[model samples]
Target: MLFAFSIAPAGTPGDSVSAAVADAVRVVRESGLPNETTSMFTTIEAETWDEGMDVIKRAVEAVQAHAPRVSLVLKADIRPGHTGQLRSKVERVEAALDEG
Candidate 1:
């Protein structure tokens, strides 16, 4: 499964939320799962639903330490019996573009 999520502290004083976001990303990185952090979201490849949700839950908690409330946006591509779709899926698209 590929789980992409964004977690941020809301109603904070500053215009920037990079610090809090970094905390969330740190959690993802520490998980040692196949993952990528982009400007909008962090995407992780997990073998099971529990694994992915556990990461997301911890990420939210990391951001929560920064503010009273947090905003989370989550999207998932749940394809069982598949692994490494994190890179393979993008590689397929890039290959298609090359073919075109």
Candidate 2:
């Protein structure tokens, strides 16, 4: 199935954002879904901010590890310079999933 997964969060503190992202990864890892893409995304925004970007990267990496066959789609509001940074990561993950 073509799944639309999103991880954008509302305005939140940097730490809380990472925490939320970790939690989401945990949930996905534990959900035991055959296709991770079939599982809905949760609290992805927590992984989007400057402070939270690393956490977001780690979380997505974890997800990729746990569900190597799943596709991931990430959406973010970005200005000119940052237009495709996170989006690039998301696409990379999706490509990896496709390859796997």
Candidate 3:
């Protein structure tokens, strides 16, 4: 499963939300799952829905600690028998571009 999500604190004073975002990313990093953090979202690969959601729940909680409310955007591609799609999916696209 490939779970991509963006979590952040809402209604903060300053324009910067980096501190709260960093906390969420920290939780994902410590999970030992296949993961990547980009400007807009963090993507993680997990074997089951429970495993993936647990990480996201904790990430939301991390951001929630900094503010009264949190905003989360999530997208998932769940394939039961597939693993390592996190990097493999991108590699396949790049390979296709190279071939073209």
Candidate 4:
């Protein structure tokens, strides 16, 4: 399964959210899962549903320590027997664009 998520803290003083976003990304990176962090979301691949949710849980907790309100957006692709789709998905799109 592949999970893409974006987490942020609400009602922060500053206009920039890089700090809170950094907190969330740090946790996701520390999980050691096959993951990618883009401008909008972080995509991670996990063999099991529990593994993916556990990573999200830890990430949310890390962000919550600073801000009182936290927001999370998660999208999951539950394709059994699939792996490496994280990178392959983008590569496929790029390949088609190149051909066109």
Candidate 5:
């Protein structure tokens, strides 16, 4: 399964949540999972549903410390027996774009 999630601290400094975001991303990366982070979300590929959700759980905790409120947006693509789609999915789309 592949999960993409964005977690941020609300009521933080101005409109910039980078500092808190960094803290959360750090946890996700340190999990040693295949993950990609964009401006809005962090995508993680894990072998099992539990493993994936656990990573996101840690990330949210990491952000909660920085602000009084936390906001999270999560999306998931659950396809059993699939792996590496995290990168390959985008690669396939880009390949199609190139063909066009």
Candidate 6:
């Protein structure tokens, strides 16, 4: 299986969330999954939200390695009032790849 995730800066740059995300990706890769793809997204630091799902969609296609299946992940925080649309896109891609 392939594991993927996207991350937003939880707080200040010194918060260490970015480091954790990187470490998580490394651990997932070390586990010996068939394929792995990671998309790191950063929104406008001033704007709370922006429509960047298109980037995620394209990144998945671009990063897919030579493997039977592609596993997509978004490491963004989905909290109250968050739409979590990227998560849906990731799942859809995973489903489409599996159907092939």
Ranking by TM-score: 3, 1, 5, 4, 2, 6
Write the number of the candidate with greater TM-score, choosing between 2 and 4.
4
Candidate 5 lDDT for residue 65? 90
Candidate 4 lDDT tens digits, 57-86: 999998898789999999999999989998
Q: Which pairs in model 6 have colliding backbones?
A: 4-73, 5-75, 6-74, 6-75
- Clashing residue pairs, backbone N/CA/C < 3 A, model 5: none
Winner of 1 and 4 under lDDT: 1
* Candidate 6 Cα errors over 4 Å, as ranges: 1-4, 14-18, 39-100
TM-score for candidate 5, residues paired by index: 0.94
Taken over the whole model, the C-alpha lDDT of each candidate is 0.95, 0.44, 0.96, 0.91, 0.94, 0.40
How far residue 23's Cα lies from its native spot in candidate 2, in Å, is 7.6
- Estimate the TM-score of every prediction: 0.98, 0.30, 0.98, 0.92, 0.94, 0.27
Off by over 4 Å in 3: none
Q: Lowest lDDT 10-mer window, candidate 3?
A: 7-16
lDDT of 5 by residue, 1-100 (tens): 9999999899866988888999999999999999999888999999999999999999999999999999999999999998899989989999999999
Better of 1 and 4 by TM-score: 1
Query: Please, what are the lDDT tens digits per residue for candidate 3 over residues 13-35?
Result: 99899999999999999999999
lDDT of 5: 0.94
Kindly list the per-residue Cα lDDT of model 6 for residues 1-100, writing each as its tens digit: 1123453333243534444445444434443332244356322111122323434444344333222334454544433353444355569899999999
Candidate topping lDDT: 3
- Superposed by TM-score, candidate 6 places the C-alpha of residue 70 at a distance from the truth, in angstroms, of 24
| Model 2 TM-score relative to the real fold | 0.30
RMSD of every candidate to native, in Å, equals: 0.5, 14.9, 0.5, 1.1, 1.0, 15.5
Off by over 4 Å in 4: none
Can you rank all candidates by lDDT, best first? 3, 1, 5, 4, 2, 6
